[model samples]
Target chain A: MEPERFRELLDAYGGEEQRWPAEHRQAMRALYTGDSGARADVQRARELDLLLDSYRVKAPDLTQRIIDRVAPTGLGRFFAWLQPTVPAQWWRPATAFALPLLLGVALGLSDGSSGASTTVIDWELQEQALLSVTNEEPWYE
Target chain B: MQRDEENELVRRITRGDRAAFAVLVGQHQRALTNYTRRMLTDTDLADDVVQETFLRLWTQAARYDAGTARLTTWLHNIAHNLCIDSFRRSSRISFSDDADSTLESDDAPDSAEHSRERSDAVRQAVASLPERQRSALILCHYQGLSNRDAAEILDVSVDALESLLARARRRLKQLLEEFHGA
Candidate 1:
């Protein structure tokens, strides 16, 4: 690999060999061993990686809170009951799952918090662009 | 969990199977939470964002296309969008608020106080980055996401993602050097 290409890969994937793209790993290893400049770049990337790793997070469990907000009713509730009892794991298709649920059920299940509404509005504003991740529009400036 | 298992769980979740939903949550909550917490630098906001992400998963389970992206990448995309929304809604981005809460792990390379101070410096430096750069770095470096997946989440090309990562690291190096120099 050329010096510039090596530096780009180093910057993008960091100094860790394991994190390097598999296809380029062999070339990168050869360059790292033969080139002092590449080694220096790797050292810088390694230091940054160590610093980045220093920042950690311990998040609280929100599983119950999220589950409680689902609140299935009527047929949905029946299915919820029947789900465990069913033996064969038949699944509906991605298209079939798009059928809209009742508005009343949506309202009924609402946690009545601003979060749901805020998120809905956010999605609504970006719905056209968000449906596809490959959209060119940036999420933020 | 494996991709097949995640797909199955998501399929069950679409049918209102709370058990599968719970299982999915148990699998991803920590990583998702860590992503949001680092993005927002606020525990409560991160929790709310995560709740909203999973809630969307529960409600919009049908929207998920396994062919498009992996389960974890999709979830991170949801949380990242929410974090951006949170950024727009509020101007209060403080690194100090959650800096102390991090780096509580028992194994430290130095004294606890010194480690925390260094950790705080890193957090502040990361927080100071432009939103895109920070997301790029956090998703790829901290979240251990592949560049392709991170680019998809950021809605950028692989080259663009690399650019963001490179800029982020360069800026972080400058910031940290300045911090130590000070």
Candidate 2:
């Protein structure tokens, strides 16, 4: 490596050979071996590296706090259990089919497809229908 | 953690396994915290960013591609992006007022004091570097990431990352010299 190139790398990567780009390590070592000026530059870079090392980071552990926030709630956990463990490709077609079916079910419920006054029992039936549509196995016998 | 193990944990996590998520957090917490602290210079802010990063991991585990990058690289990428968002939110990066003290065990009081002063100077010098340069240095130097991985985190080419590292070192040396003649 040329002197200027060596200095540029020394400035960027510091004086540590391990930190230097693998492609140039042999050339850099050869240059440092033969050149006093290159050695001096490396020494200067090492000084800066050591100085930089002095600033050690001591951070607090926030593991549980993070975990608490991300843990699934009861409802989310229920849906999570329903999610397929198969490769994601299995779900794409399922989702495409399920979305239109869900929309149709919503429309039918709103339209009062039974042609009679809707009641609490009707709402329960609608909920069950939506749940059954979402999962392969029926929610009711 | 090995990539295969991490992949397995993530696979389990995708299936809503709390145990797997906790395991991932345990593996990366210290390294992520240390990287964030060095990048942001505030312990509280760094912790918040690290938390956000893991939360994203929980939500976005399906999006991660192990073939594209290691879990550490992916985690750092998430943390790095959040750090950038924080910079934008605050309209500027803030430097910590307190410099970190060295953990040397010295018998002589005077030598310890001198060592502390030098360490303080170095910390301030690093904290004062420009954002890109500081990120490049911290990812490659303190985090022990390879140049290619650090480059990916910074969204820069390896050559560009190297340029940033060089400039950071040059500026750091100047800053240290001005701070304490070190």
Candidate 3:
């Protein structure tokens, strides 16, 4: 690695050699051992690391709090009930049988509508009246 | 946590298993919270964001494709996105008021006051960084996430992430020098 590339890697990764990319580690180590300027750059990076470590936040143990907030409740429960767990394969056959049955029921209910049946009846009556008139007026005339 | 174990827990969570959700929470809460706290510099907001992160995991568990990334990387992605949202919603970034409380209470018996001052200066410098730079620093430097993982969380290429980290460190060094000089 060039001097500038080594500096960039040190700045980006940190002073620790292990944190540096594995592929470049051998080259970086050789440069570091051979060059005084590279050593200074690593030392500066380590200083920054020390400053960062000093400000480490004590992460609060909020596991239960997070659990409570994320715990499914009220509307969550409703959605939970609606979530399908059965495999799609299981539903495929069931849906196939159910879909045709549902279509038949829907057709039957639509066929039973009073307005449609009434219209059919009116058409049949007109046909019968025409037939009677025609039969009576035929042969003698 | 083992990848297989985490994956199994997530699978159970997808099935609406609360106990499994709790286990997952226990496994990752501290790391997530610390990452947020460092990024946002506000403990309360960090906590709120962390809670929302887990809640999102619960709600969006089915969207998790373990084939692509580890669970920690995925979780950090969610947390990082939420933190960005929080920043946009409120364009204010302030240091935590409680930042020095621990320093004050320390019984280190030497230069406690000096340590507090130095620590405060460092925190201010970190907080002063741009949002992306600060996130890159927090994830890689403090949280110990790999560059690739941090880039994934930040939605940037690894090269872009390294650029951000470099700028952040350069600025931090300058700021710390100025603080000490003052």
Which candidate wins on DockQ? 2
Candidate 3 lDDT, B1-182, residue by residue in tens: 78999999999998878999999898899899888887787788788778767877888889999999999999999889878877886778967777865333264646666677787888888889999999998888877888888888888999999999999988888888854323
Q: Which candidate should be chosen as best, given TM-score against the real structure?
A: 1
- TM-score for every candidate vs. truth? 0.75, 0.74, 0.74
DockQ of 3: 0.23
Which runs of model 3 end up more than 4 angstroms from their true locations? A72-141, B102-107, B178-182
Task: Please provide, for model 1 over A40-136, each residue's C-alpha lDDT reduced to its tens digit, 9 standing for 90 to 100.
Answer: 9788788777777777777777777767666665455434332321112124332234435455567766756435455335666587666666666
Candidate 2: regions farther than 4 A off:
A72-141, B95-108, B178-182
- At residue A62, candidate 1 shows an lDDT of 76
TM-score of 2: 0.74
lDDT of 2 at B23: 96
Candidate 3 C-alpha lDDT tens digits along A1-141: 899899889989889876776778899999999899899888877777777666756787898766655445646644432333222224545665699999999998887873544434588889999998877855756
Decide which is better by TM-score, 1 or 2: 1
Docking class of 2: acceptable
Per-prediction count of colliding residue pairs?
A: 0, 1, 0
**Model 1 chain B: worst 10 consecutive residues (lDDT sum):** B94-103
The residue-by-residue lDDT of candidate 2 on B1-182, one tens digit each, is 78899999999888878889999999998899988887787667888778778877887789999999999999999999878777766766676655442234353888767777776667667777888998999998888888989999998999899999988988887788854335
